[model samples]
Target: MFNLSYTKSFMIKQKFTIEVKIIFLILTTVTVVISLLILFFTTKEKELLITLGISPKEIELFINRVSQELILFLGITILVLLIILSILVKKILSPIFKLSLATRTVASGNLDYPIELKTQDEIGEIAKDFTVIERSLKATIRDLRERNKEIELLSKITTKMTTRLNSQEIIGLIIEDLTTELGYDYILVSKLSEDGEYSQDHIFSGDTQMKQAIEDILEEKIENIKAPVSKLPFLPDVSSGKIVIKERLADFIGEVIGESQSDAIQLMLGAKNFVDVPLHIKEKPTYLLLIATSKETITKHDKDILHTFMRAASIGLENALLYEEKTRWADELEKKVEERTKELEEMTAKIAHQEKMVALGTMASRMSHELKNPLAIIRSNVYFLKKKVPMELMKYLDMIGRAEERSNIVVEETMGFVKGVSLKKELANINDCIEEALRSLSHELKKVEVEKEFSEDIPSVLIDVHWIHNLFTNIFINAVQAMEEEGVFHPEGELIGKITIKSCVVNSNIEVSISDTGKGVPQDIKDRIFDPFFGTKIRGTGLGLSISREIIEKHKGSINVFNNESGGATFTVVIPIPE
Candidate 1:
């Protein structure tokens, strides 16, 4: 019940295992044979001398001479045997030693070095096998590297395609990316004709010579392209809408051209390995992507990458087309709305509603086209500046970025909604914007006693300047008309009517109260004041208060009305001041 140890024991498995035993056995056998020969001759000396028919005195001399020659001959024979055995051992195992060294060299990443051993035995066969393995390993590593390069190129193309939405721009980018990745000697993109032939509208990019050669090839086969590939030198990719690659394109083209019109194609394209991928947009095959390279065989994985890139370009082009269509619709609608505006009295209220939509669309498209570029620049610059400024200044940069984002949202809303009004928001002192609004209606409000109780210490709030100006003007106009009709304003320019506007910060919000000394909002329709098309005036559009409420809510603010205890109605507006 013990764990077995791999350590060698002294008797069972000695250090001198087989090699020492072979040397020991050889020496022992040689020594014992020499000893027996000397002992047998020396012991039979008397018998051998008498048989030789010589005197006993001469017999001693003969025996001594014979023993001396025997020992010398044995010495020379043993030396020769040792030399032969040394050479034989080295010859027998030399391929094995060389094979081991070559394996180590290959393992160390020296794949360019070759394994060479010449013999006619099992060892030679083993060396040949090692040579095959070396070749296979190098091919596998090369293939893996090529696959990784293709994947990286595909990722870069994806990044570039996602940032662009225009069709031609996307196609141009695809041509550039694919040409760079595939290292094509010739790249040609041609639109297909109504008869399914290759059209002349081809986009080609690559070497000048290769492009010319490809152009010649196309010209020669111009009248024969009845199908993607019908007796064509290069097979077309009609089956899958992808590329058809031919590794032996040079030979095929040479055969087609009758070995007359040939130049560097056979040499440059290295057997004319090429691909032809069809660029399909909205499921209609329109353009063909042709590429021919000198080196690097185009595999199926590479084709897959190219196909995916082409697919993205097609989608981007479709989106661009749809946007163009939407733009056209918006323009036509605006023109119709403009014609309707001139005849507002004759047209129904439904026409007026259409005017609102037209206004929104025209403003949105114009503003989006104008502000998108600058706003993007502002946001990016602010972000860059935020990184370099001190911690204290970061808050201001962040605020500026937020303001840009809000402006972009307004642009998006205009384009996204037909009846919605988009507002460009910024931090403004409500008192100043309100003053500007009242000034916009100065001639009408001249006779009214407009009192302002503005708080100078109030924090700045984010509100749309133009929209807030309109909101204040609408209220002032309503108040002025009411007072003028009620005889609250005297004819001698004496201001008898009063309009009070006050603003102050209240618990993280800026509140503005505009109160008028006139008839209050009717009790029955007080809740419907902000409702669209609910005005009681004969010519009022009824959209003023409704739009004002929408602009307030978009800024994350609120507005409501209350009956004054003294004599009029008060309109209260609350806007948050971001901390």
Candidate 2:
């Protein structure tokens, strides 16, 4: 549109030009008519003026002056018209040039160029249309820039997700991008339990004070907040891969936790709107991405961007879960392989031990047969010499008898240990066997006190009475010897060592515990104490505990030793009770 003053001025200038032309035409016409009339009357008027005593020079002067005045008036009018026309043209051309310059400025990509047109003419109309085009171009460019930004953000997020395999790390990256890149006020990623019965916050970002306030209301840290799915009534639908948008932040929070806390949280967080997007892998939603913002409106473009982002996230999260599962399986398989290899090694060692023991057993049997007659003959002669020898020589004969006795005992124990004992099972009371063994070692126990606690409920068990008696005898002998070696007797020659034996029923087994007041077994060699040929004593056959273990095993029982709190060791033997 053109300006009013300029339109009026243009009209006035055109009217003035037309009037000037008209006036000039009328004057020229009038002059032509007068000349014709004067020509017609000039001859008669001139003669009349001459007859009336007028001169020829005066008449000529009058005509010439009248013609000059008319020509001068016409010249002044034409000059005035030319001046008005020039002003109108200048006014019209100035705006046209300005509009042209504006068009060029806009074409050069400067949409902010000012366009002002004062004329109400065709040029002004063109300027109006040009202003509209400039505004439209500015808006289109602005939209394009925003779209490019969203594309760049998606590209960066995709790159980051590719490098991260852990679900938590991927989640952290996503949250980081939303807050830092997209300028979100708060983000909460809640993971739904596999059973779909609970929703727990896995990661959170933004508004520390708001987070603290919500944490206080929930009585948990924001990240550790776990609430039942029933509390979040919309979770079932969300877990079904639905995206929920809530315009009222308070209502959203209320639905998530409770209405009592929603108002307070919304006030603290300055939240205006939020969106719940289900994060899925393999078509199953496992997480809910809650995005809250302070902006008054969340446009469709924002939702579209978020939707595209989550689709990529699902792929990343699925790969991450697979990687985690693969790692766990690899570790478990490695552990199983190691365990199987160790079991194989143990079996190989056990087989080698059995083979060596069989060879030793054969050699022991042969040696025992060869030495039996010599030992018998030596013992018989020693007994004969001890009686016939003089009083002074009786001590020497006694020493010989003791040496032969020790040699016979060594050969018997070696044979017993190498060749495993065969059980002659008989239903008998275990306390009776203990009593018999104690009776046989009475002479050695002269410096040791023996206490017994035999349970009244001890039942008859199917056991080899001979071997059971021998087992206790070996144990009692060892206890007695341990005390003797440590000089456990009192200075007055009184017995100080004590052996306490007890029997009880435990579970389906009979347990016998024998504790001594002597020095306990050394911890360093405790495990090897039951190994054949391993001993601490100077003259021990080293087969006592080993043979005892074999006898227990033959009876389908177990034997173990531990130090008593009192001072010495206690050997406990457990024999299963027959049903």
Candidate with top TM-score is 2
Which runs in model 1 stand beyond 4 Å of their true positions?
A: 1-80, 90-96, 112-173, 185-275, 279-287, 290-579
Candidate 1 lDDT by residue in tens digits, 192-212:
765456665665555566666
Q: Please give the TM-score that candidate 1 achieves against the real structure.
A: 0.35
lDDT of 2 by residue, 63-132 (tens): 4665576557656765676576568656765686576567656665678998988567888888888888
* Regions of model 2 farther than 4 Å from truth: 1-114, 120-126, 152-164, 168-307, 383-409, 426-432, 442-447, 452-462, 484-496, 503-510, 522-528, 531-541, 576-579
C-alpha RMSD values across all candidates: 25.0, 13.3
Cα error of candidate 2 at position 263, Å:
16
